[model samples]
Target: MPDLLGRKFTANEPNRVYVGDMYLPACDRGGKNMYLATVIDAYSRKLAGYALADHMRVSLVIDALAHAHGVRGSLDGAIFHSDRGSVYTSQAFRNYCSSLGVRQPMGAVGTSADNALAESFNAL
Candidate 1:
């Protein structure tokens, strides 16, 4: 994967580009943390899809993207930009993206600015 997004986070229309990422929320009274994966449409800056799980595995991200596909009805030529995390870079995730005809672009290593949209969302 390459940084195809080139740090540009805007899109001309919905599903043209999507920025997504996974985060771990604050632990609850049970001291258990939940992982959340989110997809935001760049054009509208709205939440297109999301998935929460007990673990931040590849399936978490996959399910998030799948939700986007279901909602939008198609994701054949969308760009999915995210940080270079293992869940995003895993072979399984890559294959899932390919299956949906979604291109995966990664942010630079250790560079949070490269994925500002999804990062800012997680901060909310």
Candidate 2:
């Protein structure tokens, strides 16, 4: 549980970071593969924030995080939790998080249960 607690504390930092992954359907306005957005608070059981896009590229993840931060504020030591999706694993997003002082922690690969917070949020 220490890891979870650490994530929370990291998120609570004055300008901490928050992270999550999103999945979009395989269809755009023109019927392309679209993914849904997924994000969560590392500390407050609150959903914190999220955004949607037609694509599941790293840009979508970055945009969602930007929306969350815009809603909440600065993110310094925020702990971002996510599955090992390529978008989340992308160098760009990881670099962005590092630049913002957010610790990027990937959920165990192939273990959706490990990210129950995100699963539960989606259900909500």
Candidate 3:
């Protein structure tokens, strides 16, 4: 609920901070849409987890975070930053973060600066 990271997208150690975002990869067929949610460890500068689905629901991000948990074992005392998207702000997501002992900070609306890292990752 707060700007915890304050645009400082760096972590001194792994699992301290994670940035995530969703993007739609180009599809040649164009019959169906696919969305990808990714989680990157800021300290390691590596992809910690990701999920691909035909929808951009809260589950997409949840799955990605879950994958991070699975890979990292525990997400307690970690900070997860993202844009003010509906899925990120949904109650389901908030509850998921709480269950994992993670703090979720969302950037201001209409500005990508606060979520630059994840936005850039999605662009790439």
CA lDDT scores, all candidates in order: 0.91, 0.67, 0.92
Best model per TM-score: 3
Residue 52 Cα positional deviation in candidate 2, in Å, after optimal superposition: 1.3
Clashing pairs in 3: none
User: Model 2 Cα displacement at 5 (Å)?
Assistant: 6.2
lDDT of 3: 0.92
What is the alpha-carbon lDDT for the whole of candidate 1?
0.91
Per-residue alpha-carbon lDDT of model 3 for 55-118, expressed as tens digits?
Answer: 9899999999999999998999999999989999999999999999999988999899999998
lDDT of 3 at 39: 96
Model 2 residue runs over 4 Å out of place are 1-19, 25-33
Off by over 4 Å in 1: 27-30
Model 3, residue 8: C-alpha shift (Å): 0.8
Residue-wise lDDT of candidate 2 within 1-124, one digit each (tens)? 1134322323443334444658654456776666677667645656666767776678888877877778877777677777778988899988887876777776667877666667666665
Backbone clashes in candidate 1 total 0
Ranking by lDDT: 3, 1, 2
